[model samples]
Target: MHTRYGSINREMLIKRSPGWRWIDWEELSHYRDLLYFLTIRGIRARYAQSVMGVSWAIIQPLATTLIFTVVFGNFAKLSSDGAPYLLFSFLAILPWTYFSSTITDASVSLVQNSLLITKVYFPRMFIPLASALGKWLDFSIGLLVLVVLLFYFKAAPGWELIFLPILLIILFIVSVALGLLFSAMSVQYRDVKHAMPFIIQLLMYLAPVVYSTHTIPLAWQKWYVLNPMVGVVEGFRAIFLHHPMPWNWITTGCGVSIVLFILSAAYFRRMERGFADMA
Candidate 1:
């Protein structure tokens, strides 16, 4: 059927493709407004009824930073790579918080929207994609706290600051990649919702969030960088904490994220055919 907006006319075609189908870029672009609305809706739904609302974004990382400072910095004496332990942990926590929270919401996105999924023909990918996008509001607010820390420490990022956006983009892709995989799987198996928090908790220890990469044994460092967040968290410190950029880790992690995104997108599309039935 044809949809008319003002004088412009657009046709949306719906049909079944027999085999596995990849993302329909053009089709998604046509539905861009839906993605925007969903993203906004998610942001509002998360903060609407809360008393503190957006302030929770600033509080979460600060609270985590305080706990880590007391336990790891004071007692255990974990290396913060020479920066103040508080700033170091907060920088890592900023991205990690975004990554974890996005995944948590995205994983159950399809299941939560089962009614819409069963009734609609839009790209299912948007559900998780919107979740990822919505969490950036929290991340952006957290950045303000990061700036305050930067000023308090009198630390300045040198030329390496230019790479921050690239690092964040890679981080975003990593979140979306896993989000797609888990969101699709959760539609078929309700257990994914239960297991996700535990998985994300374990993943935090795997990444160099509370400690520096220097703690990793030299021999295992190469293999450890394969986890994308290792690079992202380390890169975040390198830029904000004024440490040397770890290009090897960052490049390796970026490559892994890209490959994972392709595989996850393929799997999500392959499973898309059954989402309405299963959801």
Candidate 2:
């Protein structure tokens, strides 16, 4: 329709445009309720049709810890900085599992919700963030298991435990940042689905979940901290097991993670406009 001034309406005009648009933080805030609903829906769907349900969360990490203790701790005789190998490994696994699962689910979130993407207009970031929340349920279950394990081992965490919550916050941010990057890429490249498992598996080994960082040579220690999870896994052990704080590693890793987060957020916003069409 023409404007009252007799010019064509700007809104009705079509022009071929390319390149990214700035992220609209206000629009995302306006959709906060929708994000909450999606998050709740995701959490519910996770436990809805399972036989063991939430118990699997406890079982998976518990079993992994046992296996690592036997193979790496007993057979390989890996050191855990004087703490029991089982305790050290389980603490590391808790955060590792949460981070790994969140990234995996968030990566494919958009494609999995293609029906919604194709038919609706909403903040696309909610899809991946919602999936990440679903994985948090698993983290909660694992955390409970960790408490029980500590009780069984008769190991009370010391004052260093105070740092755990801060470490966890950093872990969550790193996961979400990496998740957002992969989620955006997955929209354009379906191969990410096939490759994600191998990538995660490789990351698991690269992380110090099964072994102590103390085993690494002094020369390699600084370089090792560059892997973001190095800080997270080691930080967990240092806090819960009362090992010396890996301050240099934690500081450097946190800095790297923040940079990654900013870059990922910018890239995600830049590519987000094409998501609906790509999905």
Candidate with the greatest TM-score versus the true structure? 1
Q: Which structure among the candidates has the greatest lDDT?
A: 1
**Which segments of model 2 are wrong by more than 4 Å?**
1-22
The lDDT of each candidate is 0.93, 0.85
Candidate 2 residue-wise lDDT, 80-137, digit = tens: 8888889988988999999998999899888899899889988888898887777878
| lDDT, residue 200, candidate 2 | 95
Q: Pull out the clashing pairs in model 2.
A: none
Q: Runs in model 1 with CA error above 4 Å?
A: 1-16
Question: How large is the C-alpha RMSD of every model relative to the true structure?
Answer: 2.5, 4.6
What total of clashing residue pairs does each candidate reach? 0, 0
Write model 1 residue lDDT over 1-279, tens digit each, in one string: 343432355654567866677788977888999999999999999999999999999999899999999999999999998889999999899999999999999999999999999997898999999999999999999988999988998987778999999899999999999999999999998999999989999999999999999999999999999999999999999998778899999999999999999999999999999898889
**TM agreement with the true structure for every prediction:** 0.94, 0.90
